[model samples]
Target: MKFKLIATFLLFATCVTAFSQEKQAQKSEKGLIKISIMYPFAEGKTFNMEYYETKHMPMVAGYLGSNLVKYTIEKGLAAGMPNQALPYMAIGTFYVKSLSDYQSAIAPNRDAIRADFANYTNVSPVILVSEVVK
Candidate 1:
């Protein structure tokens, strides 16, 4: 009887926890947009990784506020083979929860952001956006 009762209680607790988590997810904001920018690599062209990672991104975070959910930066090491030239210099990914919020917050600062590109790299960044499915 004791074993059966403990098993029943454990099952009930597990179900309740799962139900709670599902409800929480449902209540949270739904839209998540991912923006990826790939910067082409060029011989002798420069990218200031230190300034970008330390200064520019923090400025972006200041401007975007709650709209910017997260972001990541990746440096291109090689194209494929060990000796092959790199196809891209860097890649940046930014996640925003709402499109409207992003537009409102970032639109005004677009020129400033563009200008800062010179501080980082000579290559123009190719931008792409994607919506999270789920």
Candidate 2:
């Protein structure tokens, strides 16, 4: 009985490892890449609401290797108060075939975006890369 139990446990462990490997393989095959862009609103300056909503979004869409999956702009909960931080922000998520593809898409247009927002004060975008694991 003990031997049988040990054998069963071993089989279960092996199957679990195999299943994990299969899932990893499937994710690799899909070649999905995720990028997040976070922007914090600058103090005493009006955020470029119109340009972001219209121009920036459309420009991102026009990139060859990536697709804009999600875009969100939210007011900072900590808005104006004494010693309080700024209160407006935006976040954008982009999806692409691979990390290399995403890099390639943005490299050529990097200067364009910077120049477009040159007049804007306190415009900062944080970018994050991610892979879906399920």
Candidate 3:
């Protein structure tokens, strides 16, 4: 009976240690901060994809400096429903090391960035900050 009890306790301890290590590994594998800009589609709105890709994004990247890991711009194609309009016209995403770092880098450039909107689309962008977990 005592031998059985000892084996059971050892098994429990091993399981506990393995679970802890797995959790730690998952946490370490999580990715950096992701800042997403989603521009909802609306009628009578115009977007200059050329200017956005060629000029505005590069200027923004320059402002982000070392804080920015990478950035991507996605143009809206078609909606999931056939013949349905797209939910968003464009999406721009920025991967950064930290949320605070991104905020600090963008703070001073806010006005300048907003002012440059005239060079691109008139759509109001929705912003989302998230921790990438993949």
Q: Give candidates' CA RMSD values in order.
A: 5.8, 9.7, 9.5
**Candidate 2 local Cα displacement, residue 129, angstroms:** 1.6
Best by TM-score: 3
User: What TM-score fits each model?
Assistant: 0.70, 0.56, 0.76
Report the lDDT tens digits of candidate 1 across residue range 1-134. 99999999999999999999997765552567877888889888889888888887778777889888888888888889878789888888778888788778889999998898888778788888888665
lDDT of 2 by residue, 33-128 (tens): 667676776655555667776777667657743344434444445656877765447666666666776677788998987776654336667777
Q: Itemize residue pairs with steric clashes in candidate 1.
A: none
Compute the lDDT of residue 133 as modeled in candidate 1: 60
TM-score of 1: 0.70
Candidate 1 lDDT score at position 33: 83
* Structure candidate 3, residue pairs in collision: none
Query: Candidate 1: global Cα-lDDT?
Result: 0.83
| lDDT, candidates in the order shown | 0.83, 0.66, 0.88
